[model samples]
Target: MTQATLSADRSDANANANAGAAAGALRRIGAHLAPWLAPLAILLAWEFAARSGVLSTRVLPEPLAVVKAAWSLIQSGEMWADVKVSTWRAVSGFTIGGGIGLVLGLATGLFKPAEIALDSTVQMVRNIPALAMIPLVILWFGIEEQAKVFLVALGVFFPIYVNTFHGVRSVDANLGRARKARRRRRPARHPHHVSGRASAAVEERAAKRDARPRPQCPRRCARRAR
Candidate 1:
């Protein structure tokens, strides 16, 4: 082929590739945005209804008004102060509750005696709704920050504990059996050495399984807490 013709063909190929890439990127963007379309439409309708006086501002203010109010709060620094307090409460509660839940879950899941002693009591407490305790909580803590923190902690505790317990229990029994068999076969090695290695492997597998449910726990806890 002539050099000019070859160059022209190369340019056409590059253009086609770029077009294809652009189209694919647009498709991906559309896919990501598809879920927001309904919410966006609803917001538009809400705004129209409020402006046209079909909806009462007292019942549900227009989106623009809410945005303006939020902006005003932000400018006044009140929004950030509230956010800081809320964030601290959530973090402190999550840390305290999640930490204890994880430890107790691990203990119960790993040891038969611990499970026997604690699981029934934990389950009983878990059955009681957090909302039902609100009256008692008010009476005890009197609307103080400690009451709020305790409520948040109580809300966060169970999901983490239940998920962790189930995750540990879900670890394959065959894996544990295989490790035991390997330890038995290694009779020449010191008993503690072989057993220690086996236990570590088993615990590692359990730990991985335990992590799988954790991302889900936060969502569940947050919904309940709210």
Candidate 2:
């Protein structure tokens, strides 16, 4: 074969391989999507059946009827007012609560003494449901909007704090080893495996006496960092 024909043959093989990989991925996605599709299809069928009176709209409203109810609520100014009030409360609470969680998480991640002292208790308390706290929050802050905000803020705090605390307490034991290794060799590279292994090996070996021994290092170095 001519060199160009050989190259074209290799490209066609690569294209076929890529096509097979894509087909495999598409099949997996379709498998995952199948279960969800059944209920969705049923809902559409129900909606069409209800509108046509194969099912009675009188007994159960057609999908469009439900939409009309929702649309009418939207058309009326009252729905917007309620929405605005709820949005205001949720935004205020989410912002304040999420901020507190992030700060506490960062603090906990950074400090070991803080993590050991506080995290066990925090984890234990996180099991308590937020709904259970609503009564206590109301008692402390009253039925005012502040009560909701307080409840949400407390709800947001502990888990984030513990996660942050643990993150800060761990890692960096391998940093020096990594730095020294950079002077000798990288992990055994598979140059023939990549695009340009031949030229790279020639250039690297020609200049250096790869005569230096690589330092003794353990694969488990990352374990010590924590």
The whole-model lDDT of each prediction reads 0.94, 0.76
Compared with the true structure, the alpha-carbon lDDT of candidate 2 equals 0.76
Query: Where does candidate 1 stray beyond 4 Å?
Result: 1-26, 180-226
Give stretches of model 2 more than 4 Å off.
Answer: 1-36, 41-65, 169-171, 176-226
Candidate 1 to truth, TM? 0.69
* Best lDDT among the predictions, by candidate number: 1
Winner by TM-score: 1
Please count the clashing residue pairs in each candidate, in the order shown.
0, 6
lDDT per residue for candidate 2 within 61-92, as digits (tens), equals 77777888888989987789988988887788
**RMSD of model 2, in Å?**
20.4
Writing each residue's lDDT as its tens digit, candidate 1 over 16-117 gives 999999999999999999999999999999999999999999999999999999999999999999999999999999999999899999999999999999
